[model samples]
Target chain A: MKGMTIIVKTISSWVKLLIFLFGIYIVLFGHLTPGGGFAGGVIIASSYVLLMLAFGREFVEKNLSLTASSRLDCVGALMFVAIALVGMFYGAASFFWNFIHQQYLADRATEFKLVSAGIIPLCNIAIGLKVGASLFLVIFALSVFCNDFRCKGSARELM
Target chain B: MSDIPLVLPAFVCIPLVAAFLLPILGSFGRKGRVVATALANLAALSLLAMSIASTNQFSVYNVGRWSIPLGINMVLDGFSALFLITVNLVSSAALLFSVRYMEQYTAKPKYLSLFMLMVAGMNGVVLTGDLFNLFVFLEVASIASYALVGFGCDDEQLEASFKYMVLGEVGSMFILLAIGLVYGATGMLNMAYISKAIQNNPTNVVLCFALALFIAGFGLKAALVPFHAWLPDAHSSAPAPISAMLSGILIKVLGVYALVRTIFSIFGISTTVGTLLVVLGVVNMVTGAFLAIGQGDLKRLLAYSSISQVGYIFLGIGLGGALLAAGASPVWASLAILGGLFHLLNHAVSKSLLFLTSGSVEMAAGTRQLDQLGGLAEKLPLTRASCAVASASIVGIPPFGGFWSKLILVIAAIGAGVYWAAALIVAVSVCTLIMYLKVHRYVFLGELSETRQQIKESRGSMAVAMICLACLCVFLGLVFLAPALRAELLEPAAKVLCDGVGYADKIMEFSKDMIVCAD
Candidate 1:
């Protein structure tokens, strides 16, 4: 698809990084704050979508690519499962045990600290990556289909 | 605190990891398909082994090592175990069959991934002790099945998938609304806590409203008569192994098992709900069988037969619930539930076998149209035999799995003094017999058609899967015939439902350790 107005394109190119950084902030502070993995992920995805909107689909595709995004999606999911499974290697071998909290950070695991929540931040990061890639891919696929729908529609008109 | 059964999470974890890993491995080009197939099969086989090896016991596993109020719990009671075995058995057979069967389709890895996701979701649905988690898992499974039904991307497949999605989403919405109502009423998401709340004030109007919504929602998912519009098209249009999974286990787990769990364990079956279930059951059996008799497509016929057979299970359980509520002897009540549980297992085995045989027939003959196919008995001897065996079992012939379950249902009906329901059961069985007879006459027994003269039976993996399931169909009755096996498998599953709201007490007793842990 074609790019938007030059002004919109220029503005989005600069603003996208801010959106991405803000999404990362939300994901990191998810355990303490209102917006968490899913919400942050959507925000990050919108940043990529903003670039696609400004620079055209092909421009974004050249950089991120569908296959890369798909791979990232799978990687993100496996990462989350891996994090959960890591707890199984520790004391008592429960599926998602917070061994770090109990073993090393016991007395110091205070509220309002960045390191207090052992795995929640990691889980949030994984979830953010997955949701962001998945959403971008979905939107990209729809944009590709929009071309086909137009052709099909025109064919119907001719008939 | 009790030792957490680490194995409880494996049921959900293995399939999930396999699902994501398959696509990555599948991207390995030429060898990807082989790797994906082997990995998927390994996951399924391990699931079956785990289900079988896991003892029939009650325990709860907490997620993230959090206590009950903070994190979800996975409960492995008799009810969940029974479903776990059925889901894993059918999934293993279907996965093995798909090794060869999926060669007809592109995106083989994607298909396998979706299959595993569906399995994982169903396992989670059965294992979860929390209501919201059930909804989430239900969505995961439902979404995967929706994509699977239309995997072929054929015009008809797409149409069926869209219709299924719409109806399914509506059903899900109803469930969400009901869950919201339930939370608003009881201020709890854990099923045991909700049950405890209900027990304390059983006559709350809001809770009653939530109960009605739950029935409507879960009833739609289960595809009871009024809500089964999307089933035939979706089940018939999917690839054969997928059809097998859908007909065999998905509906049983997503629809029937969830509904029964909600009513018996969470809400505690009242006379009204029991009667409603019985009425729905009667309607489902009659409508499904009658509709099935007119179908020309083989897979469509089996799909309808699924709805009809699921009805027998509902009737059995509902009769038991009604009897228990009326304060009857516990023997007759447990007997009715036993019949239902047995029928559920019987249908899962026989119906999947039937679908697989139909798949093999389609693979060899290149058509599922009953009129276009004929006389495969001599040419495809093994498939013909498997088909005949499954058909007979479904028709409730003397020795197969379905016969014993149907017989139990009849005895239970008579015992419960529901003479009309007993009569309806027999009449529906006759209708089912007529339907399968039509299949036999048109598809297998007649003179060989010229176009199918070159058709050969399905070879290798597909053949082995069919053979195994066909054998299981015949031998499954041993669960009932062998007293010890019955005591182990079916009896305890029945008792879970028979115990009703006592499930709350059991879960509470186990989770009583959460308070101690929190300190």
Candidate 2:
């Protein structure tokens, strides 16, 4: 499929970065805010989705290839597991133990800070990465059928 | 034993990690499939090991070091341990079988990944101590199975998947609505806390409504008679190994196990619900058996048999519950529950073996219809033998796993003074025998069809998986004869159910350590 109109392309280009940054903010500050990995990840994925719509699939593929996103999805999930494993190994702690909370980060002053909440924020980042990549892949895979949908127009669009 | 608690989360975590990584690994060309297979096998094997090692061990792991009733926890009691063993054992065998069976299909890695996710979900369902988390895990297993059911992308597969998905989602909706009502009534999502709340105020109308919803929801999942429309299509349409997984253990874990846990442990079993289960069990037994005798499709017959067998398990459990509600001797109640749980384990092994044999037949003969396939005893010796073994077991022939369990059910019924139930058990066994005889006569003993002359038996991993489960079907009856093994493997599980709402106290006691650790 060809790219959308120049105006749509230009506008999406400028707005995509803001959406990406906001998603990162949501992920990083997830421990203290309403938006955590899941919400933030969807937001980030939407930015890429917007890029796909405005600049076309080829452009988005060039920027973030399917293989890379797929790899990132695995890496993010592995990172979460690693954090939990590390917690287990370091202290003989239970699964998902908050090592940071029991140690240096215990002070009340650090409770609401970005660097606080032990491994929770780290977990949020990992989950955000995985969810974003997964959503993108789903969107990308679905979009591969766009040609069929286009040929059949509104009739097959419901499929 | 102390380390067992720490290992509990690994059951859920390892599978999740493997599932996540499989797709990326699969992208690495020819070597990727091998890598995915090795990784999945390792994950499955380790889970099997842990479940076995943890047979007698009991503990609960608190998430994020949060105390129970606050943060989510994973429990490893007798009941969950038995389920863990069955799930992981079947999973490992199915994964082994899939390595060969799935080669005929494309996207092997995606298949393995989804398989791992399903394992993770079932493990989570078996282990989680919180209500909402159980729901979450149940959905995980359900969605993965839904996808796997339609994995072939054939018209029939897609249609079957849609049917299964719609019904499954409706079941899930009932469960979620029940959870919401439960939360509203008790103001808790943790199962133990909810149990504690219900025990303190045992007369809430909303909780009773929630109990009704739970039965309907989990019953739909278990595919009890009235709600069993989706099983035959979905089971028969999916790939063979997956059909084995879905029909063998998935239904048990997602349906019967969940239903049993909620009914007995969470809501606390009473005579009313007990009688309800007994009635449902009898109806499903009669209906499922009659339906199975009519099916020409091998997998469809096994699916109906699954419903029928599940009815037996429910009957035993329900009789136990009724006896308990009547304040009868604890011995009779325990014996009934034991009979039920033993049947559950027996059926899991035999049914999966049956499905795998069906897969073998399908793989070799290129057809599942009993009318089209014949004389597999000559062409596919291994499959025929294993099929015979599993068939004998399912028919409750003596010395096999199914017979001992069925005998226990009869004895339990007689001991409970429920003579009619005992007679029903014997009658069902006879019907089950006739069905299997038909299977043996038509599929294995008759003359081979002309077109199927060139058919070949499934070799290597598929044969190995079938052989292993068939051996289990033959030898599992020893658990009844061996007192020590029974005490270690099955007794603890039966005890948990027998304790009823007292599970709340036991879990709370285990959580005390976590609370101390947290401080």
Candidate 3:
């Protein structure tokens, strides 16, 4: 299917990068702020969604590719699960222990440091990647199934 | 034995890890489907082994060294352990059955992945001590089932999936609202702490409201009479193995186990709650049995029968609770609960076996219509025999597992002076017999149909799985008969409920001395 109008394409193309950066910022500072893995992941997915809207499903499929994004999704989840599993054996902690902070929190002069929360931020980033990829894959899958019969309306109507 | 507690996290962890890894690994090699199926079944097998090994044990795992009343914890008490076994055993069999049966469907890797995720979620729901965590895991399992229901992608399957999803979401919303209200009242999300708080101030209006909401939510999940509209369509439309999994153990875990645990262990069963349960149970029993007898499709008939059997379990347990609350007789109360728990186990095994046989029959004859099939006793001998065994158990024929549970329920009802309940149990048993007789007369005992000229017996893993489960169904009857076995297995589970609010005291006792030092 063809994409939307030139004006819509032009604005989304420029705005997508800023949205991606904003999502990364939220994910990175998730341990400190309200927007964590899930919220940030949704934002990142929306940026890709903007790209798909501006350039059509074919463009996104050609660029990111379905299999690559799926692999990315799995990788992100595995990374998070690995982090959690590591906590089980690390130090004398239990499953999901924040061992990093337990050992290193005292070394910091103040509590407001970036790496202060041990595993929380790392966990957040892992979850953000996983959720973002999964959301994009879901939208991509849904889009592929919407053939001529379903998407009879014009791109202008969608706009 | 000391390291047994470490096994708790692995219950949820192993499945999640396998689910995620399968998608990636399934893309490799010429035998990726083989590899993925093997890994998925390995995960399920290990779960079954672990649950059996950990039976009758009580322990708690504090995640990330988070202490009780704060960080999330997984509890493996007798009650949860019982559910753990039920979930894993059925899952192991279902996964094995799927190994052969799922060949008809596309996207084998995705199906295996979703199956593992569903296992993980059910395990989590059964084990979690935190109420909110229970909700999360319930959604995990529910969503997987929804997607799995629509896996066929046909109009019928998609419609069933949509119906199930909408009704299920409504139940979930009610549960979440109740959890929120509970936290508002007790300022705690942990079930044990909440129970303690409820006991401390047992007269809170909000907690009472929350209890009412809990019954409604969990009852919907369990598919009691009023909330059972989605069960028939969802159970029949899904693939056969999924039908087995959903009917056999999913409803019990999500609905009855959760509801009973919440009511008995957390809120502490009272006369009002107990009566409500009995009413719902009777309605479900009467309605389900009647509806089942009229169904033409084999799968639809079995699905309705699942609802009816679940009623017996609810009826038995609710009878016990009512007796316990009235201070009339703890003897009959324990007996009633024992019957209920036994019925729950028996139904899980038998119903899953029945569904698997239906799947086998459907695969063999290319139809689940009772009239189109005949004389399967000679053609698909293992499947026919397994279906017969399951039917015998379900219909409460003597010397079978279902007989003992039904007898126990009837005896408990009579001994407790609930004559109407006793009468109702007998009446439902007759109805159950009639329905199964219909299934047998139409599907297995008639003259061989002209369309079944080339019917072949389902061999290999399908036959192996069916025969193994059929053996388990027969063997379960002896568990109730053997005094030692009954004392070891069913008693502990029933005792957990009989103790009621005493559950919180035990949990608090276990978590008392352990405190993780913070920096």
Top candidate, metric DockQ = 2
The residue pairs found clashing in candidate 2 are none
Which stretch of 10 consecutive residues in model 3 chain B shows the poorest summed lDDT?
B510-519
Model 1 Cα lDDT, one tens digit per residue, B1-519: 244377899999999999988988887786977988998999999999988866478888888777675688889889888999999999999999999999988788889999999999999999999999999999999999999999987779989999999999999999999999999988999998899999999999998998898888888888999999999999999999999999999999999999999999999999898988888898899999989999999999999988898899898999999888889887878998999899999899989988998988888888899998888888888888888899888889999998999898888888878889888888898998999999888888889977777877768999999999999999998989999888778887998999999999998887786556645
lDDT of 3 by residue, B1-519 (tens): 458767999999999999989988876654987898999989999999999887788887788877878889899888888889999999999999999999888678889888989999999999999999999999999999999988887779989999999999999999999999999999999989999999899999999999989998999999998899999999999999999999999999999999998999889989988888888889989999999999999999999999999999999999999999988779999999999999999999999999999999999989898878778888887888899999999998888899999999999999999999999999998999999999988888879988777889868888888988999888899989998778668888999999998988888887774452233
Give a tens-digit lDDT track for model 2, residues B391-498.
Answer: 999889998999999999999899989999999989988888888988888889888888878878878999999999999999999988899999998999999999
The local distance difference test score of model 3 is 0.90
TM-score of chain A of 1: 0.91
Against the unseen true structure, what C-alpha lDDT does each candidate score?
Answer: 0.89, 0.89, 0.90
Instruction: Report candidate 3's interface RMSD in Å.
Output: 4.7
Sort all candidates by DockQ, best to worst. 2, 3, 1
Write the residue-wise lDDT of candidate 2 on A42-116 in tens digits.
Answer: 999999999999998889999998789889988888899888887886664767777877766876788677888
Clashes of each: 0, 0, 2
Segments in model 3 whose C-alpha atoms lie over 4 Å from true places: A4-15, A148-159, B516-519
Candidate 2: count the clashes: 0
How accurately is candidate 1 docked according to DockQ? Answer: 0.47
